[model samples]
Target chain A: AQSVTQLDSQVPVFEEAPVELRCNYSSSVSVYLFWYVQYPNQGLQLLLKYLSGSTLVKGINGFEAEFNKSQTSFHLRKPSVHISDTAEYFCAVRMRSKAAGNKLTFGGGTRVLVKP
Target chain B: GAGVSQSPSNKVTEKGKDVELRCDPISGHTALYWYRQSLGQGLEFLIYFQGNSAPDKSGLPSDRFSAERTGGSVSTLTIQRTQQEDSAVYLCASSLDRGSSGNTIYFGEGSWLTVV
Candidate 1:
Protein backbone atom coordinates (compact mmCIF):
# COMPACT_ATOMS: atom_id res chain seq x y z
CA ALA A 1 0.00 0.00 0.00
CA GLN A 2 1.13 3.55 -0.80
CA SER A 3 0.75 6.19 1.89
CA VAL A 4 1.40 9.94 1.79
CA THR A 5 2.03 12.15 4.79
CA GLN A 6 1.91 15.92 4.73
CA LEU A 7 4.09 17.38 7.43
CA ASP A 8 2.06 20.49 8.07
CA SER A 9 -1.67 20.92 8.59
CA GLN A 10 -1.79 24.70 8.51
CA VAL A 11 0.64 27.25 7.12
CA PRO A 12 0.09 30.93 7.89
CA VAL A 13 1.97 33.36 5.74
CA PHE A 14 1.79 37.04 4.95
CA GLU A 15 1.22 38.28 1.45
CA GLU A 16 4.33 38.28 -0.73
CA ALA A 17 6.13 35.87 1.58
CA PRO A 18 7.48 32.56 0.41
CA VAL A 19 5.90 29.30 1.57
CA GLU A 20 6.57 25.60 1.32
CA LEU A 21 4.44 22.56 2.07
CA ARG A 22 6.22 19.31 2.84
CA CYS A 23 5.07 15.84 1.80
CA ASN A 24 6.54 12.38 2.15
CA TYR A 25 5.42 8.96 0.98
CA SER A 26 6.01 5.31 1.79
CA SER A 27 5.74 2.87 -1.07
CA SER A 28 7.44 -0.38 -1.85
CA VAL A 29 7.14 0.00 -5.64
CA SER A 30 7.80 2.82 -8.03
CA VAL A 31 5.12 5.49 -7.94
CA TYR A 32 3.98 8.75 -9.49
CA LEU A 33 3.61 11.93 -7.45
CA PHE A 34 1.18 14.82 -7.74
CA TRP A 35 0.20 18.07 -6.02
CA TYR A 36 -3.34 19.36 -6.08
CA VAL A 37 -4.92 22.57 -4.77
CA GLN A 38 -8.44 23.28 -3.62
CA TYR A 39 -9.67 26.76 -3.02
CA PRO A 40 -12.43 27.56 -0.58
CA ASN A 41 -15.69 26.00 -1.76
CA GLN A 42 -14.04 24.81 -4.96
CA GLY A 43 -12.94 21.52 -6.43
CA LEU A 44 -9.37 20.33 -6.52
CA GLN A 45 -7.12 21.35 -9.42
CA LEU A 46 -3.86 19.81 -10.46
CA LEU A 47 -0.89 21.90 -9.46
CA LEU A 48 1.77 19.65 -10.95
CA LYS A 49 2.90 16.06 -11.24
CA TYR A 50 6.14 14.06 -11.17
CA LEU A 51 5.94 10.95 -13.31
CA SER A 52 9.49 10.24 -14.43
CA GLY A 53 11.36 13.37 -15.27
CA SER A 54 13.44 16.18 -13.83
CA THR A 55 13.10 16.23 -10.07
CA LEU A 56 12.17 19.91 -10.13
CA VAL A 57 8.60 20.36 -11.47
CA LYS A 58 6.90 23.72 -12.03
CA GLY A 59 3.19 24.12 -11.82
CA ILE A 60 0.35 26.58 -12.23
CA ASN A 61 0.00 29.85 -10.28
CA GLY A 62 3.75 30.21 -9.95
CA PHE A 63 4.03 27.15 -7.74
CA GLU A 64 6.59 24.34 -7.94
CA ALA A 65 7.67 21.13 -6.22
CA GLU A 66 10.85 19.09 -6.03
CA PHE A 67 10.66 15.32 -6.01
CA ASN A 68 13.42 13.72 -3.98
CA LYS A 69 13.78 10.01 -4.50
CA SER A 70 16.17 9.42 -1.63
CA GLN A 71 14.05 11.40 0.75
CA THR A 72 10.74 10.09 -0.62
CA SER A 73 9.51 13.65 -0.55
CA PHE A 74 7.67 16.05 -2.83
CA HIS A 75 7.56 19.51 -1.36
CA LEU A 76 5.54 22.34 -2.92
CA ARG A 77 6.99 25.82 -2.96
CA LYS A 78 5.86 29.26 -3.97
CA PRO A 79 8.34 32.11 -4.18
CA SER A 80 5.72 34.59 -3.07
CA VAL A 81 2.12 34.18 -2.08
CA HIS A 82 -0.90 36.41 -2.43
CA ILE A 83 -4.22 36.43 -0.64
CA SER A 84 -5.67 34.49 -3.52
CA ASP A 85 -3.12 31.77 -2.94
CA THR A 86 -4.88 30.70 0.23
CA ALA A 87 -6.11 27.18 -0.33
CA GLU A 88 -5.78 23.56 0.70
CA TYR A 89 -2.97 21.60 -0.87
CA PHE A 90 -2.72 17.86 -1.10
CA CYS A 91 0.11 15.51 -2.04
CA ALA A 92 -0.76 12.25 -3.72
CA VAL A 93 0.87 9.08 -5.02
CA ARG A 94 -0.03 6.29 -7.39
CA MET A 95 1.77 3.11 -8.31
CA ARG A 96 3.65 3.24 -11.60
CA SER A 97 2.80 0.88 -14.49
CA LYS A 98 -0.41 -0.74 -15.65
CA ALA A 99 -0.14 -3.73 -13.36
CA ALA A 100 -1.14 -1.46 -10.48
CA GLY A 101 -4.45 0.33 -10.15
CA ASN A 102 -4.95 4.06 -10.82
CA LYS A 103 -6.34 5.00 -7.43
CA LEU A 104 -4.50 7.91 -5.84
CA THR A 105 -3.42 7.86 -2.20
CA PHE A 106 -3.62 11.40 -0.86
CA GLY A 107 -2.10 13.09 2.15
CA GLY A 108 -4.15 14.72 4.86
CA GLY A 109 -3.60 18.13 3.18
CA THR A 110 -2.06 21.48 4.19
CA ARG A 111 -4.25 24.49 4.54
CA VAL A 112 -2.63 27.81 3.65
CA LEU A 113 -3.96 31.09 4.93
CA VAL A 114 -2.41 34.09 3.27
CA LYS A 115 -2.90 37.30 5.17
CA PRO A 116 -2.35 40.80 3.93
CA GLY B 1 -19.31 17.98 -20.15
CA ALA B 2 -15.96 19.57 -20.80
CA GLY B 3 -14.65 18.15 -17.54
CA VAL B 4 -15.56 15.66 -14.84
CA SER B 5 -19.01 16.67 -13.57
CA GLN B 6 -20.76 15.67 -10.35
CA SER B 7 -24.34 16.30 -9.36
CA PRO B 8 -26.05 17.65 -6.23
CA SER B 9 -23.43 20.09 -5.08
CA ASN B 10 -24.80 19.94 -1.53
CA LYS B 11 -27.16 17.56 0.23
CA VAL B 12 -28.63 17.31 3.70
CA THR B 13 -30.18 14.11 4.92
CA GLU B 14 -31.28 12.37 8.06
CA LYS B 15 -29.08 9.71 9.57
CA GLY B 16 -29.80 6.19 8.28
CA LYS B 17 -31.12 7.42 4.94
CA ASP B 18 -29.51 6.38 1.70
CA VAL B 19 -27.96 8.77 -0.80
CA GLU B 20 -26.60 8.42 -4.30
CA LEU B 21 -24.01 10.70 -5.85
CA ARG B 22 -23.44 10.78 -9.59
CA CYS B 23 -20.39 11.43 -11.72
CA ASP B 24 -19.91 11.95 -15.44
CA PRO B 25 -16.33 11.71 -16.55
CA ILE B 26 -14.78 13.44 -19.51
CA SER B 27 -16.01 12.33 -22.91
CA GLY B 28 -13.02 10.16 -23.85
CA HIS B 29 -11.49 9.42 -20.45
CA THR B 30 -11.34 5.73 -19.61
CA ALA B 31 -10.54 5.98 -15.90
CA LEU B 32 -12.83 7.20 -13.13
CA TYR B 33 -12.47 7.48 -9.37
CA TRP B 34 -14.43 8.39 -6.26
CA TYR B 35 -13.02 9.91 -3.09
CA ARG B 36 -14.28 11.28 0.19
CA GLN B 37 -12.97 14.44 1.83
CA SER B 38 -13.79 15.45 5.37
CA LEU B 39 -12.42 17.92 7.91
CA GLY B 40 -10.16 15.41 9.64
CA GLN B 41 -9.95 12.47 7.26
CA GLY B 42 -8.57 14.53 4.34
CA LEU B 43 -9.08 12.76 1.03
CA GLU B 44 -9.74 9.03 1.03
CA PHE B 45 -10.10 6.87 -2.05
CA LEU B 46 -13.49 5.20 -2.25
CA ILE B 47 -13.39 3.32 -5.54
CA TYR B 48 -11.87 3.22 -9.00
CA PHE B 49 -13.00 2.14 -12.46
CA GLN B 50 -10.83 1.61 -15.50
CA GLY B 51 -12.30 0.65 -18.85
CA ASN B 52 -13.99 -2.78 -18.83
CA SER B 53 -11.98 -4.22 -16.00
CA ALA B 54 -13.33 -5.07 -12.58
CA PRO B 55 -13.88 -1.98 -10.46
CA ASP B 56 -11.37 -1.65 -7.66
CA LYS B 57 -13.44 -1.52 -4.51
CA SER B 58 -10.59 -1.89 -2.07
CA GLY B 59 -10.90 1.71 -0.84
CA LEU B 60 -14.53 1.53 0.14
CA PRO B 61 -14.71 1.93 3.90
CA SER B 62 -17.35 -0.73 4.53
CA ASP B 63 -20.28 -2.74 3.20
CA ARG B 64 -22.40 0.39 3.30
CA PHE B 65 -20.39 1.89 0.43
CA SER B 66 -20.59 0.71 -3.18
CA ALA B 67 -20.12 2.19 -6.63
CA GLU B 68 -20.72 1.20 -10.24
CA ARG B 69 -19.74 2.55 -13.59
CA THR B 70 -22.32 2.08 -16.31
CA GLY B 71 -21.34 1.74 -19.98
CA GLY B 72 -17.78 2.71 -19.05
CA SER B 73 -18.59 6.39 -18.78
CA VAL B 74 -20.85 7.45 -15.93
CA SER B 75 -20.51 6.35 -12.30
CA THR B 76 -22.78 6.39 -9.31
CA LEU B 77 -21.69 6.06 -5.69
CA THR B 78 -24.29 4.63 -3.33
CA ILE B 79 -24.05 4.84 0.42
CA GLN B 80 -26.54 2.67 2.26
CA ARG B 81 -27.69 3.67 5.74
CA THR B 82 -25.68 6.81 5.79
CA GLN B 83 -24.40 8.03 9.11
CA GLN B 84 -22.96 11.25 10.46
CA GLU B 85 -19.57 9.80 9.84
CA ASP B 86 -20.48 9.62 6.17
CA SER B 87 -20.85 13.39 5.97
CA ALA B 88 -18.18 14.72 3.70
CA VAL B 89 -17.47 16.01 0.25
CA TYR B 90 -17.62 13.20 -2.28
CA LEU B 91 -15.19 13.97 -5.05
CA CYS B 92 -15.32 12.44 -8.53
CA ALA B 93 -12.42 12.42 -10.88
CA SER B 94 -11.48 11.09 -14.32
CA SER B 95 -8.32 10.60 -16.26
CA LEU B 96 -7.02 9.38 -19.59
CA ASP B 97 -4.22 7.08 -18.61
CA ARG B 98 -1.26 6.85 -20.97
CA GLY B 99 0.87 4.45 -19.01
CA SER B 100 4.35 5.73 -18.14
CA SER B 101 3.83 8.61 -20.56
CA GLY B 102 1.91 10.40 -17.77
CA ASN B 103 -1.61 11.86 -17.54
CA THR B 104 -3.54 14.25 -15.37
CA ILE B 105 -6.56 13.23 -13.34
CA TYR B 106 -9.22 15.93 -13.44
CA PHE B 107 -11.59 16.28 -10.52
CA GLY B 108 -15.13 17.53 -10.11
CA GLU B 109 -16.15 20.19 -7.63
CA GLY B 110 -17.54 17.42 -5.39
CA SER B 111 -20.82 16.74 -3.63
CA TRP B 112 -21.08 18.06 -0.10
CA LEU B 113 -23.04 15.53 1.93
CA THR B 114 -24.36 16.39 5.38
CA VAL B 115 -25.96 13.72 7.50
CA VAL B 116 -27.79 14.79 10.62
Candidate 2:
Protein backbone atom coordinates (compact mmCIF):
# COMPACT_ATOMS: atom_id res chain seq x y z
CA ALA A 1 0.00 0.00 0.00
CA GLN A 2 1.08 3.57 -0.70
CA SER A 3 0.63 6.54 1.60
CA VAL A 4 1.50 10.23 1.80
CA THR A 5 2.41 12.22 4.88
CA GLN A 6 2.45 16.02 5.15
CA LEU A 7 4.30 16.97 8.29
CA ASP A 8 2.80 20.39 8.73
CA SER A 9 -0.90 20.86 9.26
CA GLN A 10 -0.57 24.59 8.81
CA VAL A 11 2.10 27.03 7.64
CA PRO A 12 2.05 30.76 8.23
CA VAL A 13 4.10 33.20 6.16
CA PHE A 14 4.11 36.91 5.40
CA GLU A 15 3.76 38.32 1.93
CA GLU A 16 7.04 38.34 -0.04
CA ALA A 17 8.49 35.65 2.27
CA PRO A 18 9.59 32.27 1.06
CA VAL A 19 7.77 29.11 2.13
CA GLU A 20 8.07 25.38 1.87
CA LEU A 21 5.50 22.63 2.40
CA ARG A 22 6.95 19.25 3.27
CA CYS A 23 5.64 15.98 1.86
CA ASN A 24 6.87 12.40 2.18
CA TYR A 25 5.54 9.21 0.68
CA SER A 26 5.91 5.48 1.24
CA SER A 27 5.56 3.31 -1.82
CA SER A 28 6.89 -0.05 -2.87
CA VAL A 29 7.39 1.02 -6.50
CA SER A 30 8.02 4.06 -8.62
CA VAL A 31 5.25 6.66 -8.25
CA TYR A 32 4.01 9.90 -9.76
CA LEU A 33 3.78 12.88 -7.43
CA PHE A 34 1.59 15.99 -7.58
CA TRP A 35 0.67 19.13 -5.71
CA TYR A 36 -2.81 20.71 -5.68
CA VAL A 37 -4.14 23.91 -4.23
CA GLN A 38 -7.68 24.75 -3.13
CA TYR A 39 -8.75 28.28 -2.47
CA PRO A 40 -11.71 29.28 -0.32
CA ASN A 41 -14.99 28.06 -1.83
CA GLN A 42 -13.25 26.85 -4.98
CA GLY A 43 -12.23 23.66 -6.66
CA LEU A 44 -8.75 22.21 -6.47
CA GLN A 45 -6.20 23.36 -9.03
CA LEU A 46 -3.04 21.56 -10.00
CA LEU A 47 0.13 23.29 -8.92
CA LEU A 48 2.61 20.84 -10.40
CA LYS A 49 3.43 17.22 -11.09
CA TYR A 50 6.54 15.02 -11.20
CA LEU A 51 6.30 12.08 -13.58
CA SER A 52 9.81 11.62 -14.97
CA GLY A 53 13.02 13.34 -16.00
CA SER A 54 14.03 16.44 -14.06
CA THR A 55 14.17 16.26 -10.30
CA LEU A 56 13.18 19.90 -9.91
CA VAL A 57 9.72 20.48 -11.47
CA LYS A 58 8.38 23.99 -11.78
CA GLY A 59 4.69 24.71 -11.59
CA ILE A 60 2.18 27.52 -11.83
CA ASN A 61 2.34 30.66 -9.71
CA GLY A 62 6.11 30.40 -9.56
CA PHE A 63 5.90 27.35 -7.30
CA GLU A 64 8.17 24.35 -7.64
CA ALA A 65 9.00 20.99 -6.05
CA GLU A 66 11.92 18.60 -6.03
CA PHE A 67 11.50 14.88 -6.17
CA ASN A 68 14.19 13.36 -3.96
CA LYS A 69 14.28 9.67 -4.74
CA SER A 70 16.58 8.76 -1.86
CA GLN A 71 14.58 10.59 0.79
CA THR A 72 11.20 9.73 -0.76
CA SER A 73 10.23 13.35 -0.42
CA PHE A 74 8.61 15.89 -2.81
CA HIS A 75 8.48 19.20 -1.04
CA LEU A 76 6.82 22.30 -2.58
CA ARG A 77 8.52 25.67 -2.43
CA LYS A 78 8.01 29.27 -3.52
CA PRO A 79 10.51 32.11 -3.48
CA SER A 80 7.80 34.54 -2.35
CA VAL A 81 4.10 34.20 -1.69
CA HIS A 82 1.17 36.54 -1.98
CA ILE A 83 -2.03 36.93 -0.01
CA SER A 84 -3.79 35.16 -2.86
CA ASP A 85 -1.69 32.12 -2.05
CA THR A 86 -3.68 31.48 1.10
CA ALA A 87 -5.17 28.12 0.41
CA GLU A 88 -5.13 24.47 1.38
CA TYR A 89 -2.41 22.50 -0.38
CA PHE A 90 -2.39 18.77 -0.87
CA CYS A 91 0.34 16.31 -1.85
CA ALA A 92 -0.57 13.17 -3.70
CA VAL A 93 1.10 10.02 -5.04
CA ARG A 94 0.06 7.51 -7.68
CA MET A 95 1.62 4.19 -8.50
CA ARG A 96 3.32 4.05 -11.88
CA SER A 97 1.90 0.82 -13.19
CA LYS A 98 -0.86 -0.44 -15.41
CA ALA A 99 -2.14 -2.88 -12.81
CA ALA A 100 -2.26 -0.23 -10.07
CA GLY A 101 -5.61 1.18 -11.33
CA ASN A 102 -4.24 4.74 -11.28
CA LYS A 103 -5.49 5.48 -7.81
CA LEU A 104 -4.15 8.53 -6.00
CA THR A 105 -3.30 8.56 -2.32
CA PHE A 106 -3.26 12.03 -0.83
CA GLY A 107 -1.62 13.64 2.18
CA GLY A 108 -3.48 15.18 5.11
CA GLY A 109 -3.08 18.63 3.48
CA THR A 110 -1.29 21.74 4.72
CA ARG A 111 -3.18 25.00 5.08
CA VAL A 112 -1.01 27.84 3.79
CA LEU A 113 -1.87 31.10 5.51
CA VAL A 114 -0.31 34.03 3.75
CA LYS A 115 -0.51 37.23 5.76
CA PRO A 116 0.17 40.82 4.82
CA GLY B 1 -17.44 21.41 -19.84
CA ALA B 2 -14.01 22.99 -19.92
CA GLY B 3 -13.07 21.25 -16.70
CA VAL B 4 -14.45 18.62 -14.36
CA SER B 5 -17.85 19.67 -13.07
CA GLN B 6 -19.67 18.46 -9.95
CA SER B 7 -23.30 19.14 -9.11
CA PRO B 8 -25.09 20.22 -5.96
CA SER B 9 -22.13 22.18 -4.66
CA ASN B 10 -23.60 21.79 -1.19
CA LYS B 11 -26.01 19.13 0.07
CA VAL B 12 -27.61 18.72 3.48
CA THR B 13 -29.21 15.42 4.31
CA GLU B 14 -30.29 13.55 7.41
CA LYS B 15 -28.66 10.41 8.67
CA GLY B 16 -29.99 7.17 7.21
CA LYS B 17 -30.93 8.97 4.02
CA ASP B 18 -29.61 8.27 0.54
CA VAL B 19 -27.62 10.79 -1.43
CA GLU B 20 -26.24 10.90 -4.93
CA LEU B 21 -23.35 13.08 -6.04
CA ARG B 22 -22.74 13.70 -9.70
CA CYS B 23 -19.56 14.39 -11.65
CA ASP B 24 -19.06 15.51 -15.24
CA PRO B 25 -15.59 14.95 -16.51
CA ILE B 26 -13.83 16.76 -19.29
CA SER B 27 -15.18 16.14 -22.78
CA GLY B 28 -12.41 13.83 -23.92
CA HIS B 29 -11.16 12.45 -20.64
CA THR B 30 -11.03 8.68 -20.55
CA ALA B 31 -10.45 8.32 -16.83
CA LEU B 32 -12.62 9.53 -13.95
CA TYR B 33 -12.14 9.22 -10.21
CA TRP B 34 -14.04 9.87 -6.99
CA TYR B 35 -12.44 11.01 -3.76
CA ARG B 36 -13.61 12.09 -0.34
CA GLN B 37 -12.18 14.93 1.71
CA SER B 38 -12.98 15.22 5.38
CA LEU B 39 -11.45 16.89 8.37
CA GLY B 40 -10.56 13.55 9.88
CA GLN B 41 -9.52 11.65 6.77
CA GLY B 42 -8.07 14.39 4.61
CA LEU B 43 -8.46 13.01 1.07
CA GLU B 44 -9.11 9.39 0.12
CA PHE B 45 -9.83 7.69 -3.14
CA LEU B 46 -13.22 6.00 -3.38
CA ILE B 47 -13.45 4.61 -6.89
CA TYR B 48 -12.14 4.94 -10.44
CA PHE B 49 -13.53 4.43 -13.94
CA GLN B 50 -11.45 4.20 -17.08
CA GLY B 51 -13.09 3.93 -20.47
CA ASN B 52 -15.15 0.69 -20.40
CA SER B 53 -13.02 -1.26 -18.00
CA ALA B 54 -14.44 -2.56 -14.73
CA PRO B 55 -14.33 0.16 -12.16
CA ASP B 56 -11.81 -0.27 -9.37
CA LYS B 57 -13.94 -0.22 -6.22
CA SER B 58 -11.20 -1.34 -3.88
CA GLY B 59 -11.05 2.07 -2.25
CA LEU B 60 -14.72 2.15 -1.26
CA PRO B 61 -15.13 2.23 2.48
CA SER B 62 -18.13 -0.08 2.62
CA ASP B 63 -20.93 -1.74 0.68
CA ARG B 64 -23.12 1.32 1.14
CA PHE B 65 -20.89 3.26 -1.22
CA SER B 66 -21.25 2.77 -4.95
CA ALA B 67 -20.51 4.67 -8.18
CA GLU B 68 -21.32 4.48 -11.86
CA ARG B 69 -20.12 6.21 -14.99
CA THR B 70 -22.52 6.29 -17.91
CA GLY B 71 -21.36 6.72 -21.53
CA GLY B 72 -17.88 7.19 -20.11
CA SER B 73 -18.55 10.84 -19.33
CA VAL B 74 -20.78 11.45 -16.32
CA SER B 75 -20.36 9.69 -12.98
CA THR B 76 -22.47 9.51 -9.89
CA LEU B 77 -21.42 8.41 -6.44
CA THR B 78 -24.26 6.96 -4.40
CA ILE B 79 -24.08 6.53 -0.67
CA GLN B 80 -26.96 4.67 0.89
CA ARG B 81 -28.00 5.10 4.51
CA THR B 82 -25.58 7.90 4.98
CA GLN B 83 -24.03 8.52 8.37
CA GLN B 84 -22.45 11.49 10.06
CA GLU B 85 -19.12 10.09 9.10
CA ASP B 86 -20.17 10.48 5.46
CA SER B 87 -20.28 14.23 5.79
CA ALA B 88 -17.44 15.60 3.74
CA VAL B 89 -16.45 17.01 0.38
CA TYR B 90 -16.84 14.55 -2.46
CA LEU B 91 -14.41 15.47 -5.21
CA CYS B 92 -14.27 14.25 -8.78
CA ALA B 93 -11.34 14.34 -11.17
CA SER B 94 -10.57 13.30 -14.72
CA SER B 95 -7.59 12.71 -16.94
CA LEU B 96 -6.95 11.85 -20.57
CA ASP B 97 -5.99 8.30 -19.76
CA ARG B 98 -4.56 6.13 -17.01
CA GLY B 99 -1.07 4.64 -16.72
CA SER B 100 0.37 7.21 -19.08
CA SER B 101 3.35 9.35 -18.27
CA GLY B 102 2.61 12.97 -17.32
CA ASN B 103 -1.15 12.49 -17.11
CA THR B 104 -2.34 15.49 -15.18
CA ILE B 105 -5.66 15.08 -13.40
CA TYR B 106 -8.08 17.97 -13.00
CA PHE B 107 -10.47 18.25 -10.04
CA GLY B 108 -13.94 19.65 -9.58
CA GLU B 109 -14.94 22.09 -6.87
CA GLY B 110 -16.48 19.16 -5.00
CA SER B 111 -19.89 18.52 -3.49
CA TRP B 112 -20.05 19.37 0.18
CA LEU B 113 -22.29 16.92 2.00
CA THR B 114 -23.52 17.58 5.51
CA VAL B 115 -25.34 14.89 7.44
CA VAL B 116 -27.58 16.09 10.23
In model 2, state the lDDT of residue B9: 95
Residue B50, model 1, lDDT: 84
Quantify all predictions' global Cα lDDT against the true fold.
0.92, 0.93
Stretches of candidate 1 exceeding 4 Å from the true structure: none
Task: Write out the backbone clash pairs for model 2.
Answer: none
The digit string of per-residue lDDT tens for model 2 on B1-116 reads 69899999999999999999999999999999999988878888999898999999988999999999999899999999999999999999999884483598899999999999
List, residue by residue over A32-106, the lDDT tens digit for candidate 2: 999999999887899999999999999999999999999999999999999999999999998888575588889
Superposed on the true interface residues, model 2 gives a C-alpha RMSD in angstroms of: 1.5
Computed on C-alphas against the true complex, the DockQ of each candidate is 0.69, 0.71
Query: Clashing residue pairs, candidate 1?
Result: none
